[model samples]
Target: METRPRGRDGTGVTNTDAGPGLVEPVPGYRTRVVDEGARDGPAVVLLHGTPLDLRAWDPLVPALRATRRVVRFDARGHGVAEDVPVPDVGRLAADVVAVLDHLGVADAHVVGHSWGGEIAQRVAVEHPGRVARLSLVCTRASPFPPFGELAASLRGGTVDLEALLGRWFTPAERAEPAGAAATVRAWLRDADRERWAEALDMIATFDGLADLAAVAAPADVVVAELDAVATPAHMAEIARTLPDAACHVLPGARHLAPLQHADAIARVLLA
Candidate 1:
């Protein structure tokens, strides 16, 4: 049975394509993909973060799908893991291309959040022709420092999830029963521990600051004013590195902007 994707209301969102289904972008690596929205609109491919699945972008879908062909899928190892290699930033970017090839989409606007944003950068830099534009939310182009210690804690089964959640969102957002913070908490709580740890290790090894110059796509950098990890200044610095990019800062926002500021982000993507 498929896990129905719910909206902010807790009841599931309308399955514009009868809900997400399994598709093998690569043989034996079945991925849960949701391909819906306006059939003739420009393609928009959404990539999710490390601990989250396709649902991380759910809140923004309705707004985009009104006039866009929206495609989102679980990262290779998340959701229904099958025959696949260990997760990493580069391999994860390959999965993005595989999905586009499987869908026969020549190019699309790629949007990614957090770890997903890292994958977006890889796609733009390596497979430049496949990306028309980029929307990077709460992300960075440099090596993330804390992942080393975070990976260690994950390996030791000592990650303070509650504290992690606090960093991800504010108390008010977390208190909302069907809001982003709570939903993220559910995802964090249910994540496969070893895979999560391995993914973090992969992230710790990533160093993309030098590669930004190769990304030729027109891009938008979206960051939260209050996000400690992906700070506004850091995100702005990344924007400066890009050949053509604009930075937008959400006042007092935190890490998960898709869920926290979906409408605002949707406007940026559409603009």
Candidate 2:
């Protein structure tokens, strides 16, 4: 079945409905696929963080499409994708490769936010040939510190979305997330608890500090000054380790900068 996730307008506001462009890969898992931009332009894949689906990129897609073919999808176990086991980062990267192969993209600029950033890091190092440019947004070089507490809380099989959202957005955004909050809540409500927990576990234990320098692709490290998890300092450290990487921090933004400051993110990615 094909569906169209409500496409967002130019100002980065998210609409609370699914729009067109869903595809089921012949030999891959089912995930919501939103392909935009010129087919002949350079391919770029946008990966979202935990709990949030591909729609998180609705606001940024237009800007990205101006210069490249932007491909965004729901990672497995989130959004419309199947609730498969959350294997190691290598396997997760392979899944991304499968998506790219299905789309006939030989290589792409891989942009990942938060947990997805961790996956992108692994992909750049493990599957260098498939990644042309690596952009890590609001990401860190070590395990997410809050994972232990998050895992323990999820043991009861309930997600305190309010609390989770609190950490992701700034005070202004929390007060008025401009429809993003509603969209994320809907996504989490539809998500499987076990699969989400598994993804969290994978993020909690992920540490790519040692192999970061091995990433051959030119990299861009973006961070939000107000982000508690992937702090600016942490992102700077990551930039220092990568052989070809630069860091940019958005003032007053939080962990979910991609959604909060879509234009700024697009500027960095486009630059």
Task: State which candidate has the highest lDDT.
Answer: 1
Residue-wise lDDT of candidate 2 within 54-130, one digit each (tens)? 87787888887777888887787777674655677787788788888878899999999988999899889889999
Which residue window of length 10 is worst by lDDT in model 1?
A: 1-10
Error of 2 at 44 (Å): 0.6
The local distance difference test score of model 2 is: 0.78
Go through the candidates in order and give each one's C-alpha lDDT.
0.81, 0.78
Clashes of 1: 0
Off by over 4 Å in 1: 1-20, 82-85
Residues 1-271 of candidate 1 have per-residue lDDT tens digits of 1243554444443333744366778776886777899879999999877777787787899899979999998886566552244566777889899988987899999999988899999999889999999989998777776887897898798999989998977677678877666777777877777777666666677678779888889999998998887888889898988989988888878888887799889989999
Cα-based TM-score, every candidate: 0.91, 0.87
Q: Residue 163 deviation, candidate 2, in Å?
A: 1.8
